[model samples]
Target: MAYVAAAAVLLGLLVVTNLILTVGVVRRLREHTAELAALRGGGSGGLDVDVAMPAGTPVGGFDATSVADLPVSLATLGERPLVGFFSPNCQPCKEKLPSFVEYAATRPQGRDAVLAVTIGTREETAALAELLGPVATVVVESDQGPVQRAFGVSGFPAFVLVEEGVVSASGFDLAPVVDRDAVALPAAG
Candidate 1:
């Protein structure tokens, strides 16, 4: 009878400890959720993560050499240029490469209007630079390169439309920047 009584007490203590831990975990989760909500533009209910520099932000100055040995800088971006920041290791950047390439191919100013910055070494970025060369002026730079710092890039696969050295539109999605050139055509006869 005494053994049974001791076993019951131990079990009760274990259950109480478990409850306390569970409560602590739940409270921590709530606190985390609230913090995340605050970071999401103060409970605006928008889940869009702000990955890169926002629109209308002035692009900082940068001077870099492209894979083709061509000079590319803030001043040489022309009237408006589509700039894409990519990393060789980023999965999303690989996935988005095709779309960006296709978009660049259609640009009116040709390859000069597109700047593709790859954050990697020559050995690692060779294939990516090769692929992007046909469509864009490819620049291979190390992590936190001048081009990235100039554009204020915070994440990979960031697209920024720069007009007169100022960011016209910037985001992770290509649709917003691509849509700038989209014009509805008249119905065929």
Candidate 2:
């Protein structure tokens, strides 16, 4: 009888813990949605994740303004939307590339639109091109100066989806496109 009582108590505790966790998750998601909505309504400046370094913090041996100067033009990259800013050395970038590639292949917007930009030397860029294969449009920004700052990218594998010269989305969540039915996932067999 004691053993059965203990099991019942444990089960009750487990249920309570799960409920707390679920409530916390839902609250967090609501905050994020509200924040995203506010950012969207603000217009043009783009969403800035707090993780990005402050303006003066040194990165890649360059200041923010220097990083911002890497020249980019919509014309040079073609008419498709740009998915710029990543580094060859970043582990998360490496892991995420496969998903980006797969996403690009399956969705027309992704296929025609996404471009992966890497800050590396010519040889390094070539190696990355090999790594990514023909799955993405890979470009090298040998000098990270202006280019990095302009896009406000302080980390590896930052993605900005640009359409018609406007920044549509930025950061890790591709959920907007995925959820909006803009990009279709692979059909279940």
Candidate 3:
């Protein structure tokens, strides 16, 4: 009888320990999720504390030649253009490339309405440029290139939806840009 009681006590302790560890893990995961969301520009933080340029910021003037040898500039961007900044060495940029391309493909104006700026050497950026070519106007530039500088982009995989040279939506994730046109109005009461 004593042995049975001791065994029961040990099992209870083990179960309690497991529950505590699980709670700790869940708490830690929540914290990490919040941090990642902030980094991804999903929070209320502005560009000063956020990952990239914020919505409503005006795009500064910039001029650069596309991979096709065509001139690309703020003035050349059609109304409601989508702009994406990527870096060849950034893992997140690579991971986000496919999604960006998919979203760009859905644009009504097609390739002419999207600009993809890749920051790296021509050799390093080749693959990215090719991937983005079919969907956007691919521009290869250095880290301090005019395109990135004009956008005030301090992070890779940054996306912005420009409406007449002004940012209507911008974020580290494409959600803001992709969902901008999805706003719905309420029905009359």
The residue-level lDDT of candidate 3 at 43 comes to 50
TM-score winner between 1 and 2, please give it.
1
**Cα-based lDDT at residue 104, candidate 1:** 92
How do these models rank on TM-score, best leading?
1, 3, 2
Q: Give, for candidate 2, the lowest lDDT window spanning 10 residues.
A: 59-68
For candidate 1, give the lDDT of residue 189: 10
Model 1: lDDT of residue 139: 94
lDDT tens digits by residue: candidate 2, 1-189: 999999999999999999999999999999888876644332223555532233233222222211224333454343335464657776666666676666656645543355566788756666666655455555566645455655567666665654444454555434443343243223211
Where is the poorest 10-residue window by lDDT in model 3?
180-189
Among these predictions, the greatest TM-score belongs to 1
The lDDT of model 1 is 0.81
Which portions of model 3 miss their true places by more than 4 Å?
A: 1-48, 183-189
Per residue, candidate 3 scores C-alpha lDDT tens digits across 1-189 of 999999999999999999999999999999877776666544544334534567778889898999999999877777777899999888778778899999888777789989999998889999999999999999999987888888888888888888767887887777867887334112101
**Alpha-carbon TM-score of each model against the true structure:** 0.77, 0.51, 0.73
RMSD of 1: 5.5
Put the candidates in lDDT order, highest first: 3, 1, 2
